[model samples]
Target chain A: MPRRVALEGSHAVSEAVRMADVDVIAAYPITPQTHIVERLAEMVANGELDAEFICVESEHSAMSAVVGAAACGARVFTCTAGQGLELMHEVLFVPSAMRLPVVAVIANRALSAPLNVWGDHSDVMAIRDCGWIQMFAENAQQAFDLTLCAYKVAERPDVLLPAMVHIDGFHVSHVVEPVLLPEEETVREFLPPSEYPFPLDPDRPVSMGCYGPPYIYTEVKKAQEVAIENSYEKVLETFKEFKDVFGREYRPVETYRVEDADMLLLMMGSYAETAMLAIDALRERGDNVGLVRLRLWRPFPAEELRNVLRGVKAVCVFERAISFGMGGPLCAEVRAALYHLPEGERPKVVSFVGGLGGRDVSVEEFEAMLRRAKERVSSDELEGFEFVGLRE
Target chain B: MRGELSWKELEVGAIVTEPGNAAEYRTGDWRSERPVRKQELCIMCGNCYIYCPEGCIVLKEGRYETDLYYCKGCGICANECPKGAIEMVEEGK
Candidate 1:
């Protein structure tokens, strides 16, 4: 039977991992993400979950260990944050390139300069091209739901790539919320057994991670590209299956109050909920504003985004991470996605950097950013870069 | 169009040993080289067998044997053998 539990987002993620019946859990302790692995460790020790819980030395080893296990045809999982993720940098390419369906939970946190453990999207945004399927959750419920969806989406034979579920560090990870705990049978029925196309059986041994020369390398990459792009359909299909069994609908990009609205708010992760609050308040003032929250980042929703922003006059792209010299990373990608469209049909896009180092982007501040964006749209002089609610 | 193997029968992606490598390295007759294992020094760790990259090694009676049909004379086994048990020696030397 399904039960409703009031649990923290990080705990919810751990619960989902437990419910998925993962074969291996390799993790290292890092701030804001510590509680998750700690709970998982408790579960493993108490025999509540039967999994090989490896205490890896660092996040690099954490990812590397999961890769070895997943390569040998084990359902593997791990979690990391901030510098921990940055430590796993190079190894991130191995799993997806090998088409291993390893699921990772990334508690979104800021990158360090003076060394701070706080909530932000900097860590996840940095590894945008590592060939992992990326998904963002708006709340603890979404976090729990998306983590299950990630395994289904990744393990699909046509879409055998790794997946990362991102939720803001303290904002979502540590905050307690009500999450619907689906029955074990429901999850088991939805996600089928994952086996390697060629397992590491000694009887019929096959070579993995072979060195490919230039002649065959291009074909390898072409197959990977086709696999990820083809996965968009499977992502939607899994979401539908999830809804049919579990009764929840998740789209690549979810819209909030967008119908009959002129201004669209573009953002991802937990910040979207705060933006929705601002949008609702603005709607009360008779402003035709809406929110478009991006759920899938890689195999990016290029067509879905263009469809959502098709008739909107102006768009304020709120980013939790900066790409340094190139403005916001999400903003740049969104612009590039819309660049090929006919000029007259494109939306006037502006970038806003907010919530760095876990500094709160309150509803009032979000409204202020929207006001500034609206002013830019009206005066036809909106600057490309706008830092919202900063202590300058 | 080449020596020994006709270009017509040579399929693509079939790894071929570089021609005249022994002459370039002051060694005689690269084609005759096969990996030979010193069993006394071997620990039977299977590192050579597992990392063959060509699936060319087989273990029988707790000793490693090389499958010569598909072994392209890569010498990777001799290069990576940690115990130094395997050596690339000319077949008739």
Candidate 2:
């Protein structure tokens, strides 16, 4: 039997790391993300978890240390958010390119300019192409579960790439919720000892991180892209195995109340649950509104998304990050995914950016957005994007 | 020579499995000019040997000779030689 305990989202993520029995944890402290690593440091200090907790000076060093540790065949864990993630931008490519299975938890936060430490998708969106398997957790429980699943997916012999689990900063990372804490024996059975095929050992003497000149650079990039693209199947397989062992189900894209509904709101992260409440209220009032929560960001579930939006008349994409000059990052991907659909079959996508800088997107706000989307769908004015809850 | 293998034929992460494979790649082809040794002017101080960027300069029978197979003709040997025994001569001259 598993223990049901109330844990802060950051602590929940640390609990998952503990369950994974990570060998090395290299992390630098950052807002919302600091708690996750802080708990792990205590675990290491208390000798409850036998792992190397490297307290690095900066996020760049944190990622660098994990890359080096993972290269040495150690199952490593790291956590960061906001500016810290941007700081690790250059080193982010090294782990994926070298095929190191380093698992990182990102407590998603907004980028600077105003220097805000609030929940948003800007940080994760910036590194979407960093060649890691990225997933979003809607709540604390999912954050805990996804962190465990990340290890199983990343360490697979076929997919030796790094993975990142994104939990919304403050919104989810600071909230306390009941989480099913599984036993070590159960997790060990589910996620066995990670076996790195190409560990840096003196006896083996295998060369890694070789410079790729022009002649081989394209080939190397192609291989890395193909590896990440093909990792979707392995991700689903691991999720299924996790469901069987842990009795909790997860999918790349999860839908709620879409049956017979005409309008669907698309979202990711913790706000999806809040949006569900809005959908419920709308449904109670006889409105045809539904919600589609995108769980997987990378290897973007195009097929699954298209299937879910098959007959829906309109989709309102609520994004927390903007692409500047363009609209939302996720809204653009959603449009591209549905671009090939026949003119008659496709739905009108209304893009809206909201909940930025930790602004609370209330139920009333979601209802109003739905009304505006429906109005635009009828008027055929659902072309450009809008910034919701903006004062101006 | 690595161009012989297609992208699919290469290793997963473009890892160089064989140690010291850089020796097989002759970077000397990139040279527009080659370094020549003025044997009489040479003091045998081994500055050229120490300064050769590619480590292509080797001691042969108590004298330094640049192995053109690996030398990139960077002129570092000529530039650093204390006695001016090394000269950057146009290739094939």
RMSD of each: 9.7, 3.2
- Please give the CA lDDT of all the candidate structures: 0.84, 0.91
Pull out the clashing pairs in model 2.
none
CA lDDT of B23 in candidate 2?
72
Native-to-model Cα distance after best TM-score fit, residue A385 in candidate 2, in Å: 1.2
Q: Score the docking of each candidate (DockQ).
A: 0.04, 0.54
Top-scoring candidate (TM-score):
2
Scoring model 1 with DockQ, what do you get? Answer: 0.04
lDDT of 1: 0.84
Compared with the true structure, model 2 gives a TM-score of: 0.91
Candidate 2: which stretches are off by over 4 Å? B32-69, B73-93
